[model samples]
Target chain A: MQPKSVAVVGAAETTRLGKIPDVSVIGLHADAALNAMKDAGLKPSDIDGVATAGISPVELAHYLGITPTYADGTSVGGCSFMLHVRHAAAAINAGLCKTVLITHGESGRSRVGAGGFGRAPSSLMGQFEMPYGVTSPPTMFTIPVLRYMKTHGVTEEDLATVAVIQREWAARNPRASFKDPITVDDVLNSPMIAWPFRMLMCCLVTDGGGALILTSAERAKDFPQKPVYILGTGESVETPMVSQMEDFNSSKAFRVSGKKAFDEAGIQHADVDHLMIYDAFAHLPLYGLEDLGFVKPGEAKDFIRERNTAIGGKLPMNTNGGGLSYMHSGMYGMYALQESVRQMRGTAAAQVEGAKISVSHGVGGMFAASGTVIFTNEK
Target chain B: MARLLPEPTPETRHFWEGCRDGELRLQRCTDCTHSYFPPRAFCPKCGSRDVEIYAASGKATLYSYVINHRPRPDMGTEPHSIAVVELAEGPRMMTNIVGCPQTPEALILDMPVQVRFDKQTDDISLPLFEPAKG
Candidate 1:
């Protein structure tokens, strides 16, 4: 049986990207949620469900004056929203709830107040990973990236295509952190932040918020906005600890998640008109392109170097500038969904012509959890 | 300068005791004799509670490694070699390779290595590994 259609009715975000000292994290979330509702012509009472990541769901619901019938506070890292997208869709399909609001906000770059949302203490994950002094998200990702380069002979310049190409897109995106163009030489010359990696290769940390509203297809038509359909989604866990993974060079999580999502959607890589592979680091997209079947393993570098991922390339990726240029916002996955929705609605400033199909893949917990969602204008 | 940093929990106590007593310990299934690391009480091979801890020859080869140059709070200024070693006893162990420079030229893949100890404090002597002396 085919899946029921879950349409994204509204999407909106805060004005600032890197650092917004004027607004609190909750304030940012509330603003984005209200804007999304306004854009979708939804009232607070219209939202019967709420899902949040890296922030408190109950708190966000409270601020929005929404006593949601359903709420989720899943913390699987950046990809939590991608997982939430699938969960929210299933819930609406099952008639569990309608008009779900998914939101994310963070003051990561500003390091606002040194605390906002804290996970459960009993989690051994922080202990195993943090004490090794692997505090930053990109640091953990670099481990596998380094191993990938070592095994594949992929160079730093090869991985630089992710940042360089995304930066080019950011040049056109007014909200991007970096408006200036950067070249492979600039990436190679950048200071070494991590061995086998340079400063240009890592993603930026910034403060921002993004919110999207999902409703049943039947209800979406009743709303005032165009419906961007959720084509297919898949979520899974490969390994919680970076060390436990058998293959550091390749993300088994991405391989498994992408295969399942593509198969469920009944779509091949060629069918995707655009892509939003998460760029927590430049290597992410490089490896993601390889794992998502866009290119052969160990060939992402050459593909990217050949400019296959540029603005005018075969796949116009991260059209809203991605984490490198757009807003990291703690978890960048939510923005992936936002961008896909915008593109399908033909509302994106950098909208790709005839963009009917797009893929947004999110990874969290040092390649531990992965979720992939395919969005299409056609149901 | 070598001492027991922190012994393994009940889940890995035998592995710790083996290192302390000069033996490379592995969790083995009494039924299949398969060994594993980051030890577990139950045998993964047969899903059996019938398992025993045995001493290995403390030998392994470099399965993979990365020289981490990023500044870390706990590790301080020195670059460290993070290696995943494929043990002769069958399981892979995540450990640091020390007593030599951390570089691709210095650390080669498939190079024979043996376990060593770095005494961090009274209760925590880390089990570090290094190249086996010729």
Candidate 2:
């Protein structure tokens, strides 16, 4: 269903980003939820719908004293928040709920009240992938990158350029965890976590949370802040294990979700003034740009190396420093959405000047799932 | 410290049993003629239940890989290559590359390889890969 009338009326990150050892996983959710409620000039009693990932919606609603008419807990992975936005829009358009709040919280760095995730030995991954020593995301995610590099003729230097460009974007934002400029040499020289992935190429681990409130476009104007209209949204999932991805060179989910969003938005690629591709690792943005049709396959590395996605570039992407240099609290989709809203509202820390349209895309579980959202301030 | 071990279930018992007996077994679909790894009840390609387990040719080609430097409690401090190999019968499986240096220079993509079992426990034997010998 086309949710033409749904819009983001409220958006806010937790008061403090980066490191917060004091806040539990649920506490981070409440902090961001409370901040977003204040941003929308709404109270807990005003919310009738709740959606969240990482943490359950039931816990969020009960903690915030909200009894919702509808609730959605679509936890695919980091991109779960993007899926939540899509689901919330559909729910609102269907008259399932009037006001909806979507939240995300992760204690990735602190590990306080954080949930433990692992595959059972009896599970498919445990029996197949894990037995050979594929344990964490850093290792599992690299399974495809080597193939991608070999097929595309992408060198280690080209991969380093991905980190360098994002770090350039990160240097402009104060809230970014690592603002210091890093060179391609620095990225290559950084300690190796997995082959083809160095320390600088990976995302930062921090503790933070973000939330958004959505309502019908008719009532969005009544809110204090400008409403970022949800022009289009799409989400899709592939396999549970990263090893089972249909193609090693590309993410099928990213292609499906992004194409659907672009088709629904009815906008050309040039119309996107801002873009956010979840940068959990350097290779992701490369895959995202190609899979989303912004650049041709085996060409994103050159697109980035030429400064096409950098600060002065035609397409300002990951302007919030991205998860690479910014605060990645495990589930980074919410932060990407927050930056898109901020760019549309003309209030971002590293604002892309005169930005009207923004496309926020996210990946969950090492390209296992994807969600794409197209937002615009033209109401 | 020893790394995590696989605990075979009723469905995967045959696969483990084959490995312990020095054979690489996989499932083949009667309807679609599709061969696959990781024991399952139905054929993943055609969704056919007419699947049977048989000893594979034990030949594969290196598809992709990474040399992990980070030391796990069980994996020791030295770097090792975690690789995916496409079997001759037409399915890829994750395994460690043995009988070769775990470096990008040595682990060539699409190179011919064969499976070798390393018995992790009395009942479990993990399948690994090595350069194919003439």
Candidate 3:
């Protein structure tokens, strides 16, 4: 409830990202957790609280030999880590635990010790959607985008511009997976995975993980890394089926989640010097821009086309190139959170110049869940 | 390879049976008079247990869709359209667009459509949609 009561003291991704075939899912978790622990100069014994998605918090604690007083396993999908960060901040503020470690990892491409993405025969999605030939994220996550485009009169070129601009940002970061400059024509002319969606519009399916360490703001200075204060946080969930989203043009979950964080932080859109709207697909950031109040409805496409979110733009977004050109190991929220911290710490690969505030927002499932976390370097 | 079929629960069994009988059934809340799908015992809105199963008009408008080019083992070689159609009663459900080519040019948004049942098994019949006949 109290802003700036908590801060991220340490944050790190696995030692190497993008195609870590040898690392199992749990191994990636441990890799990121240990990396973050080392970054904070803390040991496994120092963590009194633990939280994660995919693997249970209990499993993470037992695997890392931590005896935690608080643990959370709130699995909502890719954005689950954002919720973990929010919950950990609350737990630390309540004095439930001294230090908290939040972790994420997915064997999305490698499938090493990875579980299948099957649902029960009687599950809601299984019953209604699966029979309709909805096979993967490309098919399901993209269900509503066409309607949004049709209503707004957005063109395929506008959609291609999203990937083009993100690739421009990707060219600046050394950690990016695809650093080559791509044109809108390149994106439009690429292989079509689904109608209105090309290969470039979808996120990369790589193998990677990231972690964050949270503690009381009072103790934040003791850590080795710059203290990235948790300025505000909010999260919400909507319908399970993509078809059931209240509106196709805008995400109710994104609106509710983003507005809560902004209201809680007591900041305006202009206050955010850096932003990372989860780009599991290109359309997400478009929806995010409008729903988060950064742009008016139907203006997001133009905002992006005019290059406001591109490199050297007024608002430098997804500086790590986002999930579009960056490494997306299934759950992309952790990576989004990591970039925010990097910007706030002033050590990002493509750091925004003197950025003081950063907002990281994410979606889970197909517009079904959302989480927003605001960070500031100002204490 | 077989397409995934529904294993109906008591709460949702009527929906499947309605499709098998060539009817698009939905649950409507009596208290609020709100209609909905993917059957639940209590009304989603107002949480009223006072609900009834009723046959819908089967008329809908094409709300949105994607033609998945990524082939699934269960789905055939031809690209298929996965769509969500808003029914005449206001509820939306996921279904396939049939009786037309699965292309962006052919399957226009907001086009009027009517429901058609594709019987999968004796118990599980799918409610697909096609362009409204003139």
Candidate 4:
């Protein structure tokens, strides 16, 4: 269904973005949720719908003392929040609920109240993948990247440039974890985590959370904040195992979800004033750019090398520093959504001037799943 | 300490058992003739319950790989190659490329390889791949 009149009324990250050892996982969720409610000037009783991932919606409801008429616990990993926003809009339009609150919180650094994730020894990954020492994301995610480099003729300097340019954006954001500029040599010289991926290329492990409040555009004006109208949203999933992706060079899920969103929004790549592609790793933006049709396949390396995605470029991307240099609390999608809202609201720390349209895209697992959301301040 | 090993379930007992007996076993759909790995009860391709087990040719090609350098407590400090090999029977499985150095120069993409089993536990023998010698 097309999102006709749904708008984000409230959006805020946790009071403290990085390294909050004092708050547990649920506390981070509650903090972000409460802040969003206050931002929208709403109480727990004012919310009738709730959607979340990582932490269950049931637990969030109990923690916030909310009794929602509708609840969604769609946990597809990092991109789950973008999917939540899409689902929330559909639910509001269906008259299932009036106001929906979506939240995300992960104590990735502290692992406080964080759930353990691993396949059983008898599961598909255990039998087919894990026995080969493919245990963590750093290892599993590298499964496709090497082949992508080979097929695209992407050089190591091109990959390192992703980290370098993002660091340039990060240097402007005061809240960014790594504000110091890093050179391409710095990234390539950083200790290698997995082959072709150095520590600099990976996302930062921090404790943080974010929340959003959505309602029909008719009621959106009642809130204090400017409404960021939802133009389109799409979500899709591929194989759970990274190795089983349809092709190593591209993501089928990314293509499907992005096309659906762009089609629903009736917008072209040129219309996007600001963009946020969940940069959990440096290579993710390259995949997002190509798969979302913003750039041609095998050309993202050149796009970044030319600084098209950097500050003062044609397209401003990941203005909040992204997961690579910002804050990656396990699931980085919520943070991506928060940045898109900030850009649309024109209140971002590293605000893109007069940004009218913004797109937030995310990936879950390796290339296992994807969600794309398009927002416009005009409406 | 060593890396994690797979524990066979009732549905996958045959595949592991075959490895113990020096054979690479795979499941094939009786209806669609589609062969698959990691032994599932139903055929993933045709969604048919009519499936049978058969020994594979033990030949494959290196599809992709990464030389991991992180030192896990269970995996020790030495670097190892985590690879995916596309089997001659038309399925890819994640395994390690052994009998060669774990370096980018040594592990060429699309190089032909053959499976070799290493006994992890008494009841389990993990399948690993080695560079195919002509």
Q: Could you list the CA RMSD of all candidates, in the order they appear?
A: 2.9, 1.2, 0.8, 1.3
**TM-score ranking from best candidate downward:** 3, 2, 4, 1
Q: Which 10-residue span in candidate 1 chain A carries the lowest summed lDDT?
A: A118-127
For model 4 the local lDDT of residue A279 reads 84
True contacts kept of each: 0.20, 0.73, 0.90, 0.76
lDDT of 4 at A146: 81
TM-score-wise, the better of 1 and 3 is 3
Of candidates 3 and 2, the better by lDDT: 3
- Model 4, residue B62: what's the lDDT? 92
Deviation (Å) of A26 in candidate 1:
2.2
lDDT against the true structure, each candidate: 0.78, 0.90, 0.92, 0.90
Candidate 1 chain A TM-score vs. reference chain A: 0.94
Ranking by DockQ: 3, 2, 4, 1
* Collision pairs in model 1: B4-B125, B5-B123, B5-B124, B5-B125, B6-B124
Q: In candidate 4 chain A, where is summed lDDT lowest over 10 consecutive residues?
A: A127-136
Error of 1 at A324 (Å): 2.0
State the lDDT of candidate 4 residue by residue for A154-257, as single tens digits: 87788889889988889988989899999999999999888888999889999999999999999998889999999999999998887777688899999999
Name the runs in model 4 displaced over 4 angstroms. Answer: none
lDDT of 2 at A336: 97
Interface Cα RMSD in Å, per prediction: 4.8, 1.2, 0.8, 1.4
Report the lDDT tens digits of candidate 1 across residue range A1-379. 1343888888888656678887777877877888888889988998999999767888888888998888989888889998888889988887789889998887777766337532232233332233234435545567666567778988777777778888988888887888899988998888876566778877788888889999888778887888888888888887766767768767888988898889888887889998998987888887788888899988888887787778788988888888878878778888888888888888887889998898999988778888998988876
Worst 10 residues of 3 chain A by lDDT: A128-137
What stretches of model 3 exceed 4 Å from their correct place?
none
- What DockQ values do the models have? 0.33, 0.75, 0.89, 0.73
